[model samples]
Target: MSLLDSWTRDLHEAEDGTIRPTYRKGTGPGVIVIHELPGLTPAVIDFADEVVEAGFTVVLPHFFGHPEARSNPGTLTGALVQVCTSSEFTKLATGVTAPLADWLRSLARTLHAELGGPGVGALGMCFTGGFALATMVDESVAAAVVAQPSVPFAIGKKRAADLNLSPADTDAVVARAAAGCQVLGLRYRKDRATGTRFDTLRELLGDNFVGVEFEGKGHATLTEHRQQEAVDRVLEFFEEKLKG
Candidate 1:
């Protein structure tokens, strides 16, 4: 519930005029933190701070374009009601993650060259969970940790990230797993929105997947009541897998 005093935070703009706010702290390895559907909120910021405390450089790249949004009923109604009602919303949702995937890949390389390398690790949740994995394809990512990845459950809103990845793409990630790179993910036992996405990932990863199924826990509660536990486990996982 507290922001790490030592962390450095700023908003960076891409060449495309997209503004991305990122928070970073600590030294040694790097870990990119991607948020849920709600975008950059206090909760996601908390997650970033905790990752810094865990002893890695935590970069939370704000890709939502809409700054610091919350998904409370009223706020979501105001922002999304118009878009959702529009003809483009459905199609937009399906392919929204593609540009983001590209952004992360580019950022990963930038983090390596500009911030210095050994590459980086990742942590993504809800809508953006699979993004870490997508970034790994760029070779600048050494590890990934995803939780409750949603959009790709049936069909990724973005055409490129479509839930239906081709065999070649799937093989590349599988090879990454085999190559000593590590990827982990989590889910609640009761999250209906995520549906069976976690299940599919589990089967795909087999022994390589660091799967943690919360007991009696739903999606929201996974990061809510057990924030410290989640942070600790994820940090340890990154340190072990990525640092190794």
Candidate 2:
């Protein structure tokens, strides 16, 4: 049997008419777990399954790649090419939110409406990490987790410090942070892929930004590297924010 056999597959249409397949499972409060590059691999699915076991409904959206494909150099290259070339993502552009964030926000609203809680949770990893922060502009998302956000290629000083948000969206996120909405971020201290945006998050969100930095060189704290402590922290955050 496939790893996704338990998930109920469905199509979600965004406000801009973008349709994507989403796999869902579990019950209780809702959480949208966006996968890293190379699509929804087994590791990502396992993390999502943990979220379900933690007593929250989880949705895994299929953004790219063959679902359940293992992450390898070839798959990573293919997904990187797709992400770099796709018009939906903002890759190397600073101060601009990816157009794909609109779809994610739409999905958050749909989940919030379906579950009827304070709001839903959004977690994005690797290539899609900052997308979680982008979704926070909407009130429908209460708990946002950014795990190793890498965007704009982090090729330069400006791009490295950028939060992957437009001016308007940045202002909105700042306001939300000031209003007591906390954003949880996890990454390896020396992971260059994550860039210096965590510093920017600290500057912008101040104490509202909760960062969990590991002491080694590794990426994908909740997946590829798979730190149990980080996983526990994320679940604790979800329970406090979503269930409290």
Candidate 3:
């Protein structure tokens, strides 16, 4: 089915310069979905539609500036912007996931206040896997799903696997996961961008983290291959932890 046909909706979200074009739908409870670095594409919106179908209200925030990005797949996105002109990419690539951290927290808080104060779930992928975990610093967020998460700029270097999270922030989030919050991650075994990231989360979150590893797939699998399965599993993870 076409993405438009799949995610039937009348959107209620408005635009913000600080945030990429966003869309919200569904009713009862809340879940915030952050797009990957290339911005909110058709496949990404389709993910949101599926999550909304699962029953939680979904908000898909455009992480990169592809503000009007289409929902269909196979568009080539520029991963790195010239640091001199594009500060957002610079901030993200340099490990300053602070903007992301703050946005998720704020969005969660607002949803709780306006939407009966029920717990909120968060999902971030690739350039944003760590986002859901870090947002737990707020405590109001009940669950998170991190898919194909990687430290910033891992795509740039061929060698040297880095966690991409600030040492202090990673430590803090680890403590949250240890205490009570549930964190889940998904990745293909061969995707190097997320390999180091998954390794780091394993060290920090230990058994508290649930990882869904695909056998032969890689980075695109999360957004492409078996997407129905991906959305279902993530929704289950959220419901398991967030629902009363």
Candidate 4:
């Protein structure tokens, strides 16, 4: 396996008939780190390890691609094709929530209940980024980070502006925002793939949405193009929200 860490691996079954392999490590409060579409590459695993090292139990669910696949253009393209063909994802649809988010929220609740903390932390990158927002409706997610959330692929203006959330989910998230549940978002200012979803987040959550925009074109805020500031902010966010 490309991931050479002491992680416990098991299968998780969702109520919606979805079963996925889960890799877990570390201890303390629970943090769910949902990987990008190219599958859980070494960089993704490394990011999860950082979260683990920051004094939190990290759960990484293999929602797509080979868990240990090496990152390359071909592998990334293959994973992209898989994501585009999957019915569970809303690859080209605007204003539609991906069906897999429900399963993720359920997983978060399970982890939080098991670990016993103020709540759980969720960090989603790439295609799964906005899933963190959807997970917030459950109230068990105390810290949510949306890093370079590129969904519906940002193929058009509307998709660019879409939050990949259903109307009900949007309302729930907005309510949480109003209730003081802060959502952290990070993306490059010129990353077209992210579109204007950050703008949408700003509009929806107002000041509750913390948008961290870096200059130039960059994605994978917590991974490949790792930003130390972003990493520190995420750890601080988890500490502030989940460690109490």
Candidate 5:
């Protein structure tokens, strides 16, 4: 059976006319769960299921790759190629928001308008991690979680520290943070894939940035390299920010 059989699948269209498949389930406040490098693997679905059980509506948008495919080197490579070649993504540029973020922000606004809450929660992992932070620039996203945000490819010092946000978008995120919207970040201290962006987040968001760094080496905190403690912190953050 397909892992997403239980999810209500629909194609969501952004204001810019960008349409993508989205799978939604559960109830209560809404949360947008953007997949990682490969796609919506079973592990990613499992995490979303836990969020559903925790009493909140969750939406998984199919940005790229085959849904429910297991994460493997081949899958990762294929997705990377697709993302890199696509204009929607900013693979190696610094201080620029991926064009994909506009669609994501539109999705957040739609979900928030439908749910009728103060805002919606957004969790982006790995390749899409910083997307949650970008989406938070809008008032619709109240709780933003970025787990191992590896964007701009982390190829060099500049890209490593890049937040993958344009100057205007960065200012908007900073303003939102100052308005009391807290962003949660998770990653391993030694995970070079994430680069030094966490430090940049600290400098930019100040006290509004709540960082959860695990010791040792690992990546994909909420999916591939799942950590119970980190998962718990994410749930608690969602509860406090989205449901409180």
Candidate 6:
């Protein structure tokens, strides 16, 4: 059987009546794991499995692509184009939060209610990386991780600096950070795709933003060019923030 077949899948309905399929497993405080640009590939599933094994119920929303699909040039290009043209994502805009984040927040709320914990954890990678930060505006989100956030396509200086969040959302996140909710960030120092977003996060969240910067040009911190140190840091952050 395929690995995807082993996970439980359910359709989640948002407040707007839109429904999306979510793959979930494990037990404990909820953790919503958002996939990167090329969809929920095998690497993503493996990472989610790690989160599940760490003693938390994990929900992976299928925003795009086939589950368990292998990452390749063709699949990557197709997924990129789909997201770049979709209205749910702000592919080339700065200072604007994507509309899909609301749906994700709704999902988080539902999961948190079901799991009945202090709060929920969220990890967003690559194209969907900043989505985790945007979702943190909700009080239900306790642990938020942004890995290689490359939204707005990192087109220029402004795009690189933008947090992909609106002024109100940004203020809420900033206030939450000030209120003792720490945000975790992971990225490679030489990855141009990440741009200056990490720097902006540091400035916005100050010491509340714990950033783990790896050396060289690695973009996929949790998968692909997997980093053991980053994996350990992520699990530790979730445990400290969610399992406490």
> How close is every model to the real structure, measured as TM-score?
0.77, 0.99, 0.79, 0.96, 0.98, 0.98
lDDT of 5 by residue, 1-244 (tens): 8989999999999987889999999999999999998999999999999999999999999978898889999998899888988999888889899988989999999999999788999999899998998899889999999999999889989999998899999999999999989999999999998999999999998999999999978998988898999999999999999989
The predicted structure with the larger lDDT, 5 or 6, is 5
Q: List per-prediction Cα lDDT, in the order shown.
A: 0.64, 0.93, 0.66, 0.88, 0.92, 0.91
How far out, in Å, is residue 54 in model 2?
0.3
| Deviating ranges (above 4 Å) for candidate 4 | 1-5
User: What is the per-residue lDDT of model 1 for residues 1-244, given as tens digits with 9 covering 90 to 100?
Assistant: 2343455677766556656567667776788888665566666766776667777777877654244555576654554454345442232344233455666777777776665555788777775676777777777788888776665444332332343234555677778877766677776766654566556666767777777767655664335435455666787887886566
Better of 3 and 5 by TM-score: 5
TM-score of 5: 0.98
Over 4 Å off in model 6, which ranges? Answer: none
* lDDT of the structure predicted as candidate 5: 0.92
- Residues forming the 10-long window of minimal summed lDDT in candidate 2: 77-86
Deviating ranges (above 4 Å) for candidate 1: 1-19, 65-71, 77-97, 115-117, 153-168, 225-227
Error of 1 at 96 (Å): 9.9
* Candidate number with the higher lDDT (3 or 4): 4
Over the stretch 1-244, how does candidate 2's per-residue lDDT look in tens digits?
9999999999999988899999999999999999999999999999999999999999999988889999999999999888878899988889999999999999999999999888999999988999999998999999999999998778989999988999999999999878877999999999998889999999999999999999999998998898999999999999999999
Worst 10 residues of 1 by lDDT: 88-97
- The residue pairs in collision within model 1 are 93-157, 94-157, 94-158, 95-157, 95-158, 156-163
RMSD of 1: 4.5
